[model samples]
Target: MTRAKIAKTLLTLPLLSAQLLACQPADGQNPAQPGQPGSLKTLSAPSAAELQSLRSSELPEANTRFALAFFGDLLNETPRENVFISPLSLSIALSMLYQGASGETRQEIADALRYSGLSEAEINAGNLTLRKRLQNSGKGVTVQIANALWGKAGLSFNAGFLSRNQAFYDARLEALDFGSATAVARINQWASDNTNGLIPKVIEEIDPMTILILMNAIYFKGDWSEPFEASQTQERSFYKADGTTLEHPMMQRYDKFRYTNNTDAGFEAVSLPYGEAEETEMILLLPHAGKDLASLRDQLTPENWQSWLSSLRSRDGSVTLPKFKLKTERQLNDTLRRLGMVKAFSEAEAEFDSLLDNSPLKAYVSEVKQDAFIDVNEKGTEAAAVTTITVGATSIQLPQEPFEMVLDRPFLYAIYDRATESLLFMGALNSPEL
Candidate 1:
């Protein structure tokens, strides 16, 4: 199958959720409380030797490259809230990238998607078809794929009997003509159950000849060590891109935080870790007065991203930001293939010895979708994200000093692994209302 044909076949799929178990960091890493959702695990906490082995291995490079590319675009596009809670999410997401991909391909993809500010729910819902492909592959790839997909996309995932079933190991593409309505319903039920009803009515129904299904969900809650006093929250006017403004509940706090200022971009950035440094994290960027968010986003790039971080000059200052929550969903299949995952979707080039019993398969991503939800308040952050791939940052340091947190305009943000300097989530938010 050609890449074009394979992509054409990947558009169909499913929904998400699971139990809300508090995550403990593996291997002495920081463990986040139940409320800090993005603080899951990363790459299953590889041992030093194992990490070294993975680093030296020639396999998974393609996947890694793809991951980095995807994440770069995401960081460049996401809101500030999602950026802080990205590491654990990216780790789980990379596990999916590990699925049938290898060499530079896997690494690139892992690097990119791991921190691309995409929500776990959006990632999963959109990639169900790809998930279905691996789930039905009858190979060990299913666990690996599921882990990577969920981890990187900001979903909290745990491997268990359901994923380890022998029946799943023996499954095949018996032909794509089965009535998928029932299958779709069952999948939707699974999603509702997994999410504990956080997400309702996932897929309306599966149309006949459904090619794949991917789904995801996450639940997080956290309180700031020093939350903005309720008394400090007040209605304030917020200017929009248009010459319009709206009153919003703006939260204010004078607590100590990680902050910086960049004279070059005329902006100030603040970082507030969710828990300890090892747990999930969050960061916010505020442009200097008089600059709009769209302008900041337009100036964002990998190099500038690093420069922005490097330019941080922390100094104590008052901080105020709107207390808000937002949710959004989008279809992204075309966007992915357009980014360069041609082979996975082409009927002429699709190969799935990893997914089938050596049967020649014609697969193409039919669609890719994403659903993202987030809330920012004086307490902290709570969010859920889902994205489906199916087929498809630098930093700077500045003088150390206390900094202020003020978000008057749109700004860029990122979530990263403090240890590896790997970015797990990156994006810019021009409008919190979206």
Candidate 2:
């Protein structure tokens, strides 16, 4: 059996563009480009005290890194568009979704997506409106999602939980076969419609009672305002962990970049901003020669991450990165606990009753299943990810090498919130799974 692997604690920051890729509707994605007519900001601009004050003891600091599997490409060299999201508005939107969550699980989701930037009055007002929406939301597709999450039976939808198998919350008590082709077709159609054709289909079959499936899809289409010509693409060798290598199409450009070095790990980390100067940055951390990626990752404490950022020096070097398409899916329930979110998985400590209006809620996350699928071609990256929370069970990609950061063996990665120092998501890939 493949050993279970969780991502290292070294998280990556997912700025505005990355978040939009994960959450926004197709037509709503607003890219933030460099030299564009908008003001941009990042976590680096804040004071040390301010950074500290924003820290939360409730969430795991280790949850902040990016997790792209071995042999999997995490496309980091793409240019990103910028957008402004009012912290209050984003929080309200997420809260509304959480209110409909059932069982003893929604609290963790709310806490994870909470905001310190909002005032008490604002939070209260937002909660009221969100509650109303969940209660009054018509019998639309979204209601089906709420039903599945809250364990409402009879709905065609189901939450995969965090497990590797097929499990769902059916509060409506519907007898649904997850392996049915009809089931697969319904989900595929939903994905296609939701992504506005960006993701045509996610589920290909639904008749197998126990089928293991992995998925990740992202859709990003934006004009760079100043697009890179195909003629500018360069050929380069990306070092594989096996000591062999492959020549790949590498994107190259000379622009203002944020570069940093980690003395302990003997590697360099660089940041490439898409649109505005510092609005959203794609970070790449490369380990030095003869150093095990795992060993270097062991030293990735919050302090070290902060120190590494301090060492970053802006430069104008020519950057080269492989343009590759990669996708990854894994079981991550055990991983989240290893990273310090133990209470979330335990029935004794789970506190998600606030999400429902029931007493003595006898429910807990039975599993957590996640799948991430992303592709990078000439057009750009199209990726999608889903996390299933099963009360009785559980469930559930990226590319590119630039400046020769060869991830030969197992390594740590992350995608973070640059402004809040919050680790939005983190993963460790011990072995590359295709």
Candidate 3:
């Protein structure tokens, strides 16, 4: 009657999806759309007050700290161009990978993920609650998050690892023939379906050494609580980080927004709500006169971010932002290394011993990559990201000139759930790209 024995008994549990991954309606699909794919649980949207409590209680400083560090690293990758990422997606994928690690490998991943003082149980429970609650964070917004495990056909993994993720992450499992010619298409199709077609492909090819594939996809579409009128969108001079001007369509609107002008911190910010409840919001950060995006990026610490968000207040102003659409792709190996996740990626040093039941091929994370897309128009925002850990793993505001804020230069933006206070996405746009 032991837990291990129970898992062992369930080792050959029916595959959650067809062995061939035939594309059809997903299992236990959410009522929202075509790609609900085995959600297993339906979570009700929390009230604004409940969301505030969740943000305060569930969202500890660790994930937020990691999010900021992750963003800073991405900015370093491409200092003066456009870059966007979903920290939530990346964390979920890596966390799923983290479930299989042991010894030094586990320790390193915990450190890299900023889970230093927390137990794995704590992290799992927190992720579960946050993910469940945030799905309905915005009253009129659509936020879908999906996770799946694609194992090499007939592979038997540690039952504990699989069950833990299934319990905490609602991740579905499917057996897949890695050697199948259509393997790539099947995965890409799942990614497309889950992300509402925002990201149609995640992997170009399956490495011969690959045995397992874990994916996390997030799709978000929200209309601004107060949308910018299309009639007011006009060409404006937007200065790039390189000091060149790019004339792009800037959507203009006047409204009272949660605004902050912190001269000492070298940035000004504004918060724009998404749905009627306003539990989900986008925050915009612009470095004022003397500060640039680089300096602003450097200041992206958890402490500074908290200070910035706390300092916001209602202010009357006219806000101008560009109508932009951009896509991003990144290989996270280097970034993970920089963030101190050295052991997991090593073919020899890595110890994902808890992953497979009895495979002699040896398992170590081989790749970690992510693809994300974002479109910010007058209607609101449509964004999606797929973080595929090939064992690899892994906003705002406004206000007028003086009382008017014009994001005619490089700036930062974020989409977040106020209830969980968890950052869903973040980006730096030097110049508007459509």
**Best candidate (score: lDDT):** 3
Candidate 1 Cα errors over 4 Å, as ranges: 1-98, 101-182, 193-197, 216-219, 276-279, 298-307, 310-314, 347-349, 389-405, 415-417, 420-427
Writing each residue's lDDT as its tens digit, candidate 1 over 1-434 gives: 10000000000011221111111112321111122111122223335554444334432232233434444444445433232222223333333433433334433333344324433333332333222322232211111122211111121122322132112221111111125455545544544443344344545544332333334433344445456788988876655444455666777777655566667776666655554332334456566666655445555555665566565443555677776555555554443454654444444453322221222233333444554455667767555454443431004454444444555445555543233333434444444452
Predictions: Cα RMSD each: 14.2, 14.6, 11.3
Model with the higher lDDT, candidate 1 or 3: 3
Per-residue C-alpha lDDT of model 3 across residues 250-364, encoded as one tens digit per residue: 8988888888878787777888899899888888887776467787888889888888888888878778888888887777778988998997777667777677654444456
Candidate 3 minimal-lDDT segment of 10 residues? 4-13
Please give the TM-score that candidate 1 achieves against the real structure. Answer: 0.61
Return the TM-score for candidate 2, rounded to 2 decimals. 0.52
Best by TM-score: 3
Ordering by lDDT: 3, 1, 2
TM-score of 3: 0.86
- Model 3 clashes, total count: 19
How many clashes (backbone N, Cα, C below 3 Å) per candidate?
A: 112, 75, 19
Which ranges of candidate 2 are over 4 A from the true structure?
A: 1-151, 154-184, 195-229, 340-361, 376-382, 393-417, 420-434
